[model samples]
Target: MAAPDDSEDQDALYVLTAALLTPARFPAALGDDYPESCAALGLDPYPGGYGLVIGQDSDGARWTVVVDDVSLVAVAIASWDCGMEYDLSPGERTVVSVLPGWPLDLAVAAPGLPAPHDPAPEPEPSRDGSGQDGPTAGTALRLPLAPPDTGTWGPPQRRLGADEIALHWTQWRDRTEAEDAEATGTAKRSEVAKEPEVTQDSEATGTAQGADAPGESSENGSPSPGEISHPGIRRVLGELRAYLHSDTAPPLGRVRSGFAPDGARMLRADGPGWSFVARTDDMAFVLLDEEPGEVLPVGRGSELPPLLKALDAMAVRPA
Candidate 1:
């Protein structure tokens, strides 16, 4: 694929945004785990992880420059999060592979560049769809990287819903409580003290985390979700238990732990067709491919609290 040089010339690669492709952190569009994600980009899953520097070449063709220098990209992301401008330019030596297109959707684009787009495919060596040249063969062409379709609900979309829930946990949590209150004919909001916010997103989100499901109240006086005999939730909980007892889950980052406000640990776990997000101190929201665009809440019931603690003990944490 075409790439630009380090010169501050007009033809240099124009940096737009970046992300980490590590065991604990990666775009959901790629895959649920590290090895699967690396395979999607045709790269090996190295222990140190790679940094994806998404940008446009001089022609405004989108490119994802994979680099080995994870710290450089990490620092740039941190700086940008703090509203500080830091020029993100990965050194040539750190460049691992220059992928064809952007994996995740981006709302921002570089100014003075043509709209970000995939570079036109180089004409393929003409070959019929016979035994040697078919899609499953070695000579077949590879498609450019792109984000998953938002119109459909699948594994990628499921993970994305989980991501949004984790980002807007407080909004979902409060709404869950309010919904439970309405269901039980009581005002739970006025009676309870609010804790520190888990995370927030200003972006408009109408998601599964807000879905109302049938569940009994926990001893703590909050609705306990997923304990209802919903088949999907039951299957998910079963799979989670397998991960703990039998070690039957994916090894490379199917479950991860992140920092949460007020000394809580935010957990993100993904399975074949579902995603799970919760806090050790609070409830959980599950998104499943079968349900399609709906999040099911699981409160801190007696069973769930211990399960969450076990998962947290096994989850991978950011260094």
Candidate 2:
């Protein structure tokens, strides 16, 4: 495959889709020597042939294996966003080690390379409602997956559960509110926002908004002011935001529901992106994404770690 080209715009990063299976259960349609065949292309053998499949748009930017799934269907997805901070560079490799017992999390370990700085601050609103962070239109796009070809699998049409959709919508609402507060210079996002233990600030706000925030609609039951500001398909934006925050380092243990992971590192520098590992029956995943509308479309088969985490988290809960 072609390496990423840094000189190009970040959007140039291509999402290549590969449907791979173990040698033992190799798809007869593909081939018997699929593993060896892929190995010829510099593809490393993931313990289960599950590795990343996406890459940057720069030269020498080979795709680094970051995520894998071994049980039902083993798959890996490598990804990179060219020309940006908090994104994988041409040669730096970021891996998502999801072995059987190991913490199925994501991590980026660069020995001597300079850590990239956060992208220039974007204009936001202040806490006071008078500021600009109110309602604006942002695009809503979906990052395609590999196996279930949308074209063949039919146009992107997976229905999220009501609870799942509600949770994400609530997350986006909170994210929008936090951004609005920041934009208007009204308040700051608490450092402990990621922690499950309720923060004094969040509690205060939650109480003040009482019944108006979680599970409650805006006055007249219309879109809240925050929701109106960040327009476009609501569900897609929520999914993208959550997927980009998967954990990659140690402490990879699954997340403790009702409580945040202690010392769980902030993988993304953006104000609210955070991640933790959670598991579903027979499967485990890392939940990523802390901010809404912050994810970019990587290639097909390559999705945000947070999304995998969400799926795994969903699987683990009792049906």
Candidate 3:
């Protein structure tokens, strides 16, 4: 077996995180001997002090378990453009943790992680359209037990429930709307500054002509389907939606999501072409014609902590 690269680790982490966070029940195989177990799963344990165990569940979700002699330290899951992690403690016989944007009803538990520290509550939109903090408590389950063999790993078998699908769609819609508002405001300001002063007669005639012009065709008046409503949120929502519905999840090494200080959602994708921050109702827009590998500036100082927080929570890199 060969040592895993960052991408491999990311993929495995995403699978593990999803399994741990969701309500699905899949086979979890465990082994006391790290190298032996990894070998069974076609992996080699890392040379670092931590014992690395990799495996796949029946649903095709890849899992990476990091352990020390005394306890399981962490687990990760990856599929497509998403990855997640959960830190564990040996002392806790049972642990419960919540994924930030997910509903409390979907919280899942594992055996190894210690009790999670209470994070400050984030206000989320309720069904009534009022802001309410989601409950912290989630459903509980045991950590993956050792499977009989390594070849048992396969893709997820179950489709997401309506509630699960709704959660994702709502989040995407809210983020997109926020991004669009900011972009619209900026565009309006730019247009105002560039508009030439017209004579009263010309202004009157122009208004009348515009009124008679059959209100521009929908195709020309509205944004095209390919155009993102907000450049700041960029492709984060699109990428996430695709990942959720994909039969095979891809390795998403750079995309991450979280909440802002004012309790608004935020997402960021740091790709080779462009890196941007999309906060609820605000964004750092990029030109459509921007070249690949172009390093665009994002938020700074106090404005950046939330994005960093989201990235860190997603475990884009090692915590």
Candidate 4:
């Protein structure tokens, strides 16, 4: 996995943070699927995956050091998550590519470094839209990697929204129950239990998800009286069902499962223009590019329960 040494006279990278670029887990902002995500970083979709070490070089410029040492980076991330310190200095032999800038955002900076910024530009021949201008193509003029713009509704934001829902599934679940009770004119289910009501802005997940998605209304997002069926929902469901078949399955990691509370499995799946998040034992939420900011709710009825089971059966999980 070694790369041509284009980084001449570069100082040691002061590691700030790191992330895994793998099939089962990756930064969703890059792409919906593993191959697409690797393409975004100009790397091969190696089954073993790559480790993205984000840090500032001696020059105070940000760089993403892509290394083949997946286990090392994984351990570092685990240590950080546990509030333990782990030095993540990859061996020079494991260096794959040293890319400019970061594909993901990081608030932390090295103590003594100046503000994080892009490296000095040394422009090479610009390429056509495809980026293959000549034999000199891909010869180390690494462009600064930037996070996808999420100011408006798009694929990047849609994936991030799904991430938030998964991250705060319990809050959303409680909200769904409340919404159903409100729409049905029945006493709230939690009234006897007296569970605190949750709104989208629930500190559980950072930004305000609000009661409804930005463009969504009760008429579109809840299963209270009758969950309105959309053509897009039907389309996405069909695609997901197709993925269950061996011959029709999507790429690796397109369908993935993660740990959930109470013996449930959290499922996150993405496709051409949509992302789906669900719990194996609960209902699912659908977000589509065509329908901006709307998070359509799918009830756990006759079909959905079985479908979610099938998805979990074939879905990949963290090792």
Per-candidate Cα lDDT values, in order, are 0.80, 0.29, 0.34, 0.81
Question: Candidate 4 overall Cα lDDT vs. reference?
Answer: 0.81
TM-score top scorer = 1
TM for every model, in the order presented, reads: 0.80, 0.19, 0.24, 0.79
The digit string of per-residue lDDT tens for model 2 on 1-319 reads 3433446565343333323334322222221133442333334544355433343222212232334443312212222223222332222233342111101111331222223122222333233466444454123221221222222211111111111322343354345456545644432344324434556876877654222356333322334323433333234434334434545421111122222235221111111122222211111112123332232211112123344444334221111
lDDT for each residue of candidate 4 in 227-278, tens digit (9 for 90 to 100): 4467788888888999987586688789889999999999999988999999
- Using TM-score as the yardstick, the better of models 2 and 3 is 3
lDDT of 3 by residue, 153-181 (tens): 21110111111222354454455456657
Regions of model 2 farther than 4 Å from truth: 1-47, 50-179, 184-310, 314-319
> Residue 62 of model 2: what lDDT?
22
What is candidate 3's local distance difference test score?
0.34
Question: Which candidate number has the best lDDT?
Answer: 4
Give the Cα error of residue 127 in candidate 2, in Å: 62
> If ranked by lDDT, best first, what sequence of candidates would result?
4, 1, 3, 2
Pitting candidate 1 against candidate 2, the one with the higher TM-score is 1
The residue ranges of model 3 lying beyond 4 angstroms of the native Cα positions read 1-255, 270-276, 284-319
Error of 4 at 235 (Å): 1.4
Residue pairs with colliding backbones in model 1 are: 208-294, 208-295
Ranking by TM-score: 1, 4, 3, 2
